[model samples]
Target: MKPRIIMNFALIITLYSALTFYIGWNGWIWLHTAFGLQDKWIFGVILELISFSYIIGHFLKGIPFFKVIGAYWFGLLQYAILFLPLANLIALVLIYLNLPTTTIVKWVGAFVLAAFIVLFLYGSFNAYSPVVRKYSLAIPKNAGKLTKLRIAMASDMHFGRLSGISHARRLVREVNALKPDLILMPGDIIDDDPEPFIQKNFGDVMKDLSAPLGVFGVLGNHEYYGGGIPRYLTEMNRIGITILLDQVTNIADSFYLVGRKDKTDRDRMPIEDLLMNTEINLPIIMMDHQPAELKQAEKNHVDLLLSGHTHRGQMAPNHLITKRMFEVDWGYLKKNQLHTIVSSGFGFWGPPLRIGSRSEIIQIDVTFV
Candidate 1:
């Protein structure tokens, strides 16, 4: 790595360590004072393990328990970092007011625990209960004999350990029930690893996803991160879902379905280059993982653009950041002739919790006039 890259990585490590220490220190204080927990060494060891479990999980991929702890920790870590300081401040105020330290600690701990429990329950519900987001539009172009097209698009399924067979079954059942003519998965079909997906036999559940126009997906950044493109492709292909990699296909000579490699791909073909040989008259529906370069799609005359990858922050206040980052983080955006619909995602990453955004599948009804 270059010197700057090394410096940045070191900085990140230092910050993460400092934050972990702060959280650990606060947690220790709470436990010791509130519950009279005397075992500091045991507590310290457990805290260290839990705090860095995800990083350790990366090294020890065979042990999924660490990964699970790490994932949940990551989710808790954010909220803990956000609220712990406030909790500490509240404790400080109680002290200033001459309230009993033990009483204050106990109450504060109880409140925080209750808050987390509620958040977990609510967030889990949002993560699991997917709703169909419907969109209807018309294009002044013809798609051969096809009058209307019902497209079922889902992105960031992140099928893995957390989002296991049950989630896959739900997705299959839901999408199949929609009876869409075509199914498009914009990206993140797997969650950073194809091992869990393949090992757990998720494809069996996913294979039940039915669409007459066939199921198509593209690589998300996670898929790229997993470095299992060949394995993922083979499995998807076997299950009858085509994983498009910077390729375009003519759908029954009616319209074009263009799939681009994730934006992470440095060599990903430009929109203009991808559409170079395509007929200008036919309606073109494109899928790119991240919702970047909206103008390019519009400029290239893409009739519709489908994407996911944003997860719309997946959690609250985070969506605020995502909104500023992307032109259309989640939902519809129309620029000239291009219609873009970005799904919050069917499956989630990390915590399987969604506070701001609900897990969703996009049902787009397009009529070619």
Candidate 2:
């Protein structure tokens, strides 16, 4: 790249980063106001977010020795951003309602929030990587009969500098350990741009995956956002994972996996056609990037549906709002015999911060009794 061009790109990046931070702080202020809203509890949280925000500015710049301090500061920042002004409003309302916090209670609340700030940051960023959990579900006798099945699920790999080969290796190491019948990556393996990351890391890590039933993936909203669907789809294909674009594939003889294009995609698959022959009754698992279209999964009588897009709000109180943002926030939910599991995701995305929720990869075991 030319020197002038390189300088220009850096300038653009700086501007974009500034915009992101501003939006994050602003959104969080309102988010905290909307939630985290207890008396005194909210008051302590607001102060911390400010300190941490400053820390983040330092860390991103490679300000040596400031990293750990930044970590703590960033955590407190999260708390404050989500706690203070919101608590003030709640307190005012309480006062009007003839309820006021006692002095001792206020002191205790402050102490607790201070502690919470420390813990949240440790868990969110400084903490060691989490072990992925494997789950087993027995075939319900009421269903009349069953067949053996297992699926591995992971999402939100992000695939940027923060989540490169080493991270992918750690994750694939876990995936191999599960010995799942099939591996499924629902979406967001690459945060926004899949090209650079795919060229950098995915080819090496994904090529070595151990699952015999094969690996399949679908487009996430970011896949659409970074470039058009074609380039991302082509890139994921080059890495060897099949892109299931609003289509069904019979992984094994007894079950079918239907993968839908992201709903936000202009060219999302017509779901009804994918569900052709509902009478077949073979166990069916559907994979779509976002959990937004859950009704279709239920209406199709899909035995199981898997998705990840919410990132479980990634930070505190954000998940609370995330629930309001989408019908499914995270984890397992059952509706009439159909099961949907949304993975909080395997890696962090933009902020590299996860306040309220932990990242996760899901291993599921299915069996016939």
Candidate 3:
């Protein structure tokens, strides 16, 4: 590499390393602060170092969205960060000098600023993740055939302390409130090893979820990496979300819900088998995580497909990548024989930072005349 280019590459690596560590460790810091953790001095911190391996693995797998974020906003964020440490020091000094000021007022100001930052980040990520993303279609209704088909869609539940029981119950309640005849979980149900929560009372949190027809989920790329597919599958089964691996199912006597495995699966998804099994007369709806398989979905004349892997690129300016990589990025679109709706999702997986995409639950109302 040329001298300047080499230096720039070095600088980029340094930044990536620093931020990944911070992202990894921030969870540890929160755990300590939240419950007054009394473990080994460095237990949480060590886990942070280990978690960076996933960062390295993600880069190896060619996560392209980060490049997009760097191209657009890295310059501005870097500029802000240059002054951030100094700003913190200056604030501390001011607080110390104004010791006569009320401690309550200062503490309240600090908390208010922190809450604003959290809210700002959350709202910026706001995409329409409706528990019922309503839509209409015309199908023939028999004397006693299925009239209205309901679909409940959810994604990106990180499943740590924050994403545990309470979060799942609330989202599931929101979804069940729509009374979906069918349910779909696109991917990333349990962010990492759901084992910690699953073993405790947390697993019961998901049991309250009920769908008249059934609930099905696919392996997100995270499930494969975090602890392996079977581990995630075990947890889901315990909670009763059926695992669909390159499988297709007929829904409500008119439509087909075919869930393809995540693109990360090297075993080769049996798209042809799925098509062969389903009735050609009925409209087909597919659930594939990446939205990377447009040609096949188009060729198959699928009526609609739902996915949530993009999280609308999961961060700001990065959502542009979802547009570039897939014909449909993070919302509803149709072409040729395909109608696809991509949900930005209901939970944050990594940094608790959602910049460009809204956290959501998608509801698609399928109808027969």
Candidate 4:
């Protein structure tokens, strides 16, 4: 077999084994220990089947039914992550209280399942219905010709089987209602799948979206992962979005908007080179997919930087990981007169759920000082 195939198979097996082990731990406590079922094989088989379904769904994502099943599996994984530690803690407490093993298992099992349900429901609602997060910046008076500019920005929409055309339409409507002067999308607008948009012609819905300064965007890593950057760019342009790939433009002569290609692109232009020979007096707004190389942005004197690759960890427990990885994983940060806004995301990537972070479209109101 080819080396690539061998590597892929190894990766899949490793992931499947890991998930099975995690789910099996929960199963042991809830099934045999709690309900007095002695058939370990049955529980083991159930976990194996669940993991198999999840693994298969990735290969068959083009099929809508499989995608739905895959979404459920992903959601199960997240819920398990949320409850496993709590269940373990409950088990310890019960043992300390001198409760019978069966009683302890039963109560802890029930508690864990109930908590999972509540959390899942709350997370689902939070993910599907995004709120508008607002921020204001006082710009230096000499920075621009405009006095006040309202900009609505969102990133990491990740529209696919889970977050489909309806989600896109809702985002457009909500953003339009805000009546921002300019609409900005940092990156990851598509979730590595161009088929859904192609089949549904979701771009038509996007045509309804309007902004006087025009809707401009930069590429996110997903755009490349989803396949056919040229095709995706064509579609985006058709829907009235001007994608800026290492390009700069003056929005109605008010300020400069520089759209940088995603960091994931190895051949992407350097920030310093992009700024060279450019007017520095105007307020410079940059749309970079990932919030890395902060010093570069500061060194370039970028007035504002917007991004959304982190998704603020997308779910609980993992949100903590993202927080630690990025200087400003979510929300707004101002340093050395340069402002950065990293959105959690306009939509989610998997499970159709959000635990620790919020799904938001940020509205940044800038008033020249």
List per-prediction Cα lDDT, in the order shown: 0.92, 0.69, 0.65, 0.84
TM-score preference between candidates 2 and 4, better one: 4
Can you write out model 3's per-residue Cα lDDT over 1-369, one digit (the tens) per residue? 699999998998798767645433433444445545567457745644443444443454344344234322332343234434454455467668875334533443455347546744554435223334555554343313676777778876766543456566678789878887777888877765555456555557776678888888877777766665676677678878788888887665766778787888788465766788676667777888777877778787677778887777766667776778877778787775567788877876554456666677777776655
| Predicted structure 3: clash tally | 10
Weakest 10 consecutive residues, lDDT, candidate 4?
49-58
Highest TM-score against the true fold, candidate: 1
Ranking by TM-score: 1, 4, 2, 3
| Regions of model 2 farther than 4 Å from truth | 1-80, 83-121, 124-128, 139-146, 277-279
Candidate 4 residue 124 Cα shift, in angstroms, is: 0.8
Question: Quick one: ranking by lDDT, best first?
Answer: 1, 4, 2, 3
TM-scores for every candidate against the unseen true structure: 0.98, 0.68, 0.68, 0.89
Query: Which candidate comes out best when scored by lDDT?
Result: 1
Tell me how candidate 1 scores on lDDT: 0.92
Error of 2 at 198 (Å): 3.1
Total clashing pairs for each candidate: 0, 11, 10, 0
Give lDDT tens digits, candidate 2, residues 142-261: 223236667788887877545667778877888888887789999887856555575575777777776777889887877776675576666667767898888888654657778888
